[model samples]
Target: MNRLTIAAIAVAVLLVTAASSLFTVQQTQQVLITQFGQPIRVIREPGLHAKIPFIQSVIALDRRLLDFEASGEEVILGDQRRLIVDSFTRYRITDPLLYFQTAGVAENGIRGRLASIVSSALRRVLGNEALLNVLSVDRLRIMNEIRDQVNREAKRFGVDVEDVRIRRADLPEENTQAVLSRMQSERERVAREARAEGAEQGARIRAAADRDRTVLLAEATSNADILRGQGEQEAIAISAAAFEKDPDFFRFWRSMQAYREAFSEGGDSRLLLSPDSEFFRYFRELPTVTP
Candidate 1:
């Protein structure tokens, strides 16, 4: 080889070696130094890290929070009700060395272990709770409990569980239908009670209205009787006044009124009485003719 070509080849070889030895770890990542497939040291702080070129290697792990979701599981609650629980977790690798030792620095391994821990914790914690609590407003409290339990266990795997959440907790289809039917029946019962109460109230109102109507009619009748008595008294006083004005004319007017009434269409029936009866005085007292 030429001397210039030899110098360029040596420089290129050194550059490749240097590049192989140095690796940059960003803020979101961590590195594990492994020699011959065995981890020796873990570099956590974000910066440039060096390893033996071609003899030792580096495995990068995410230091940032990671997400994992376990497959949906069926669990029986304290009330003997079955639920399908789908849960997710947020965690981070706090100890890369421990993680490397436990799961060989693979993200999948970490996720697998986390899934087991979360699943076990979820079952243990939720198994003791009633189904109502699981489906109720206290669901968040149950999730918090599961998170705490999982966090404690995940610490052994060099993980810090940030939070655990249940994405869905659903009853089996048959159970759901049963519950819906029961709820519908309960609502119908309440409706019936309300309708009965309304009918009772309506009856009371109608009875009260009838009583008021009866009272009004009685009062009207009493007022009418009072008016009729007053009218009779006034009529008697008028008759007395006319008698005082002229006794003969008053008597004649009374006789004429009696005769007209007795012979009218309403009282045209014959009467059996003496001809000399005073009722015929008007007829007998006709003015004598002077022929």
Candidate 2:
């Protein structure tokens, strides 16, 4: 063979080799290369790569996180309240081999699968709770359950779910009015009961006080009557004793007291005396009576 032909053949062989063994990957990507329809290389770094030309091809996939979110929907909480829930999720590809095998150069399929699984988890977990549970600290527990359950199923799809978050929860328009009305009714009923109890207790206390006062007044009146009767009897006994000791003097004093009691405040004072009369004979013959 001539040297020119030998050199030309060698050059052609080198070019074919270069073309078959060359590939590229990005910083956010992982690649799998197949030779004769069999996976022969798994490249996870971002750099230039080489593969068998014509008989080998590469499948590249993103290695970054993606978002999965659900539309707003109503759910019942643990307290029998209605809640509207909106949520979102964050996930990433954890197993490139499974991801490639299952999705095969179409990450959309994995995302779609994850969406279904996560949504189902959310519905199933949230359905057991009430609106108050969703609004309060208990939501953390429910969210954890949802994330764990979704992750359990999503591992089959080559996804590692990072977190689940609820955006909003709300009550339906029709239910708000009913809830408010029920609350008002309950408050009014409680207030009325309290007021009635207070009034009833007040009336009982007043009646008790009145009964005590009546008893006190009756006792006071009876005591006064007893004292007055005792005083009158004592006065009568003293007067009788004095009259027994000095009958004439007692009669004269009694007559003077009666005259004073019967007299008016202001009237003409009249006096009539007869020296020779029998009533004045004691004063006229005082010397003889003494003798």
Candidate 3:
């Protein structure tokens, strides 16, 4: 071969060696240097890193948070109720050496181990709680407990469990309809009690109103009777006073009133009496006047 071609071949080999010996550590990545499947050193800071071309290898790990989700699982609670729980976890690889030893350098292995740890934590913590507590507002506290437990177990795997949360917690499909029916029955019972209480109050108010109306009417009737009796007494006293003032005029007025009342608007009315009867006294003769 020519000298220039040999030099070109030599330069190509050097570039390949340089490329294989150098790897970039990104801001979001941590790397592990492994020799023949044995981790030798861990690189946490971000920058350019180097390893042996063929003997030492670089295993890049994500330094940022990772998400892990557990499959939906049915668990029995302390109350003997069944719940299907789906959970999610957020974690980070804290120690790359321990992570490589425990979970290997692959993402799948890390995820598998973490998911198992989270599931066990969930089962242990939630199994002791009643179903109501699992579904209540205190679920935040339950999640914290699960996180604490997962973190404790995850440290062995060089993982930091930042947060653990239940994605969904629900009854089995077979039990859903029964739970709905019970809730509906409870609501109906409450409605019935409310309606009964309202009707009772309404009836009490109506009865009190009726009693008050009856009492008011009775009092009004009694007052009217007393007024009528007083008016009749006043009329009798006035008539007696007039009669005492002039006996002849009073008798004449009384007889005239009786005659008018007996004949007024009575075209078919007739009465027969003696000539000297008191009822006909005014008609028998006119009184003489002295000058």
Query: Clash number for every model?
Result: 0, 8, 0
How do the predictions measure up, each by TM-score? 0.72, 0.54, 0.73
User: Candidate order by TM-score, highest to lowest?
Assistant: 3, 1, 2
lDDT of 3 by residue, 1-291 (tens): 999999999999999999999999999989989999888998888888888998898889898999998999998887888899999999999999998888887789988888888888888888899988988988999999999999999999999999999999999999999999999999999999999999999999999999999999999999999999999999999999999999988988888888888999946778897788878766778778999
lDDT of 3 at 281: 69
Cα RMSD (Å) per model?
6.3, 11.4, 5.0
Cα deviation at 179, candidate 3, in Å, is 2.1
Q: How much lDDT does each candidate structure score?
A: 0.89, 0.81, 0.91
lDDT of 1 at 255: 85
Tell me the spans in candidate 3 whose CA falls farther than 4 Å from its real position: 212-291
* Model 2 stretches with alpha carbons more than 4 Å out: 1-20, 36-38, 76-82, 173-291
Candidate 2 accuracy as lDDT: 0.81
- Residue 269, candidate 3: how far off, in angstroms? 17
Error of 1 at 24 (Å): 1.4
Model 3 pairs whose backbones collide: none
Q: For residues 115-205, what per-residue lDDT tens digits would candidate 2 score against the true structure?
A: 6787788778887876667778998998999999988998887789888888877678898789889999999999999999999999999
Candidate 3 residue-wise lDDT at 160: 95
For candidate 3, the C-alpha RMSD (Å) to the true structure equals 5.0
Model 2 worst lDDT run, 10 consecutive residues: 279-288
Using TM-score, give the best candidate's number.
3
